[model samples]
Target: MLHSLDADLAVIDPEYQLRRAARVDNELIYLTRTGGGGARFARRIRRAREEVRTVCGVCGRPGIPRTRSRTVLCDLHWHPLTAVEKAFALSADIPEAWFTDEAEIKNDAYVARSAADQRKESANHLSERDMADLLGVTVQRVHEMFEQELLAGANHDGRVVYPRWQVMEGGRLLPHLPVVLRAADGIEARTLQAIMENVDEDLEGATPAQWLAHGGCVEPVLQTLDQWWWI
Candidate 1:
């Protein structure tokens, strides 16, 4: 699908690599990528424009469409930000021509949103409660792991404070979140601790490679738990 943009010169291939080029005309510009159903895709997207009265980007709420250039985000869930606001947040300057077209605007929005998500993720240091939620276990289990040296955490205000890295590291120890061990309702806190301790003990004699082998299931397990609404 991407080849079409290059064929049309809609993308610049400065290095002779088939890259989609940005197109500008009059007061409008667009970022084009090849995606369509023959000649039918454009028709469908156009029909969507007419038929889709409103789409809220954040909470998925329905609302009236406002055609202002920067007003693309669903008003209910997202605060519309000016291009300057985006530039400041991303620490990058955006070209003025890019804002002239709806498609380019959408692409810029995507890039800005991704940067925001990355910033949030980097700052999200998990607490004990966060780890408990991630593991589908109890706060007590985190404490137990600490006591057994299978997990490392700090004591803050007499409460166990777990950093996000610790949870990710612990996920390395047990790839899957403890959904099965959690039972239909939930596993007792002590039971969770004992299970982790046992798992850690079993791998004590194993190599780092063996540790990594078991760790690959973490993402899949997270997916399964999310599917089950266990996470």
Candidate 2:
């Protein structure tokens, strides 16, 4: 059994508690994230949009639309922002073009992939609870890794699942996964797997995962990702 302090940690972790609550009450999750209630949420959103239009959400640097970013984030703050809101949060001045969440990612010069077959890729999968155990980390860390896209996973049925291949001996993630995962933020796991496994022209021969496994630099992969248009 965990020590008393360890036992108390899960209840205290907002992500763990939120996960538990989400299993029971999705509406509660939505309400909590939106800051509660319909009218108040709308007001909060309106106020947020207004603030972002004038200043950089990251630094408060002031600039106008198009003069800064075609989107809400200013040019300096605009390096490879993903739709993962926690990873990149800004309420206002988000590009009208980029609205509907990373649709603009498609419209931008970025990586592109072909249609992925959505078969159930659930073999050797680990649950959130199981992965935490495997990594010997706190549940919160597991959530952070997944949310930050340092871990690759996909939704299977209604639940999220991570493939066993990403975890190596001693529970370490594959080399350079964090950097690669950052580029693949919105990609489906199968598509990402395909991209990583295939021998590509970019590397001049080796697959991306193989490239990294053999100690290749990550810059070339990032360049491909920079202009990646998601399929």
TM-score of each: 0.22, 0.42
User: Which 10 consecutive residues of model 1 have the lowest summed lDDT?
Assistant: 19-28
Q: Which candidate leads in lDDT?
A: 2
Full-model lDDT for every candidate: 0.39, 0.52
The residue-by-residue lDDT of candidate 1 on 1-231, one tens digit each, is 124423433223222222112111101111222322234433433334432335433223464433322223354225445767756644654344433466455645754664564445334445777777778778889768756555545443356654343344445433333332333234223222222222232245432223435464343323222222110
- Give a tens-digit lDDT track for model 2, residues 1-231: 113322333333323211111100001111112212245433443443444456543344664443211233355345555567623445565544444445445524221111111122344568888899999988788878888788887766577788776776677777878878877776657556655655656787877666776678988877655543222
How much does each candidate deviate from the true structure in C-alpha RMSD?
19.2, 20.5
Clashes of each: 4, 11
| lDDT score, candidate 2 | 0.52
**Candidate 1 similarity to native, TM-score:** 0.22
Indicate the TM-score of model 2: 0.42
